[model samples]
Target: MKSLLDLLKTKGPRDAREGAESNLFTTAFASKLAQGQSAVPWEARAVEVAATRLPKSRGTRLLQSVWAQDPYMSHLSSDRVDRMQRFFAFATISPNRDLIRQDEYGSFMIVLLSGTIGVDRRQPWGEHLRLAETRPGDILGEMSLLDSGIRFSTCTTLTDCEVAVLSAEAMDEMMEHDAPLAASLVALLARKLSLRLRVVSSRLSDNPHG
Candidate 1:
């Protein structure tokens, strides 16, 4: 993926005189930042800190898998990825007994870099519904972040872990800059949903009430 700084210098332009196609993508992408212009002080601060500390590309397999299967990855030219990479937020979570639910953090994607996490999809009747055990190379919280929808499950750490977080605003800014990336992201969203559907289908087939 491209770093955020690279996107600014290479993808961003100084004026509208740049060719219409180039300008179009750049302009659209820039609009995201402008649209959030009225952000509160804390929000702006969060953006700044996240942007500045966003991880630099390390050519890891997990990243490579995401780029390969994620529809949005293809839309982003290497130049764009280099630029977008800059906005990534890095986080580390140690193994704990507590559970993390969607209501706590708004929306974000957690990429497991190490260890594992247990996902429990809550039932309508207020009961724990075991989902999947996520490990390194797995992506958690993507469903909510991708669609700007509510989180579907609760995640709990099983071991010390590190993860990459991509928030909604950051995602919006990245998409605004590149049309292809937006299209790709939508595709990725579809793929993920389809996979989940298949899993659900298999479960239903095996056990009618499940």
Candidate 2:
């Protein structure tokens, strides 16, 4: 399926910004989830194994302390930290576990409060391409989190890692309970996706093979 970004480029998919699951997650990926991980809901699947839930107060403090040093993270004001805390659940994952897998359905996004995550994609010709290594404050599964599209790459915990998760259910609650914060969050995600599309376009323009 074409990404919401792709649709946007052609002046379509107006609902993408509002977290629409219309054609994206409700398609094949959702079926796959029902067939395989049917016993557990989407959010439970994201927690993985060995991920201990951290207390809210400690988690908020930690999340506020290390927004992952990513300058893009600064798009969110630090003053909003306290309010944002309740919407997120903090967990620590043991190493060698896939936080998220390529081409799989995901209903949430994670902020890396601490620890390393290796982001990779499995190419059609059997190559495992290492896309990036996540740092503190890095966000994973955000694209899927926003659009409910299947993940484009796999994100694996390379070491013990602490993360803050924002699930779809939580987002819904936030929208109902705190509309302003929810709008701001959606705007932030839209901006981030736009920037990524621009970067990809520039790279494709530069690629000699293309």
- Which is the leading candidate under lDDT? 2
lDDT of 1 by residue, 69-173 (tens): 545445545655555555456555556533346333334565666668887765655656667787565666666554344456677788766566566556555
Give all TM-scores, in the order shown. 0.59, 0.74
What is residue 192's positional error in candidate 2, in angstroms? 2.4
lDDT (C-alpha, whole model) for all candidates: 0.52, 0.68
Top TM-score prediction, candidate number: 2
Lowest lDDT 10-mer window, candidate 2? 7-16
| 1-210: candidate 2 lDDT, tens digit per residue | 235444333333233344343333334345557577432233565454658877887788777777534455555577776788888988888888887888767777888887899988776767676667878877777777666666888889999998898876676566555556665666666776777668645754564443
Misplaced by over 4 Å in model 2 are 1-43, 68-70, 197-210
Q: Which TM-score value belongs to model 1?
A: 0.59
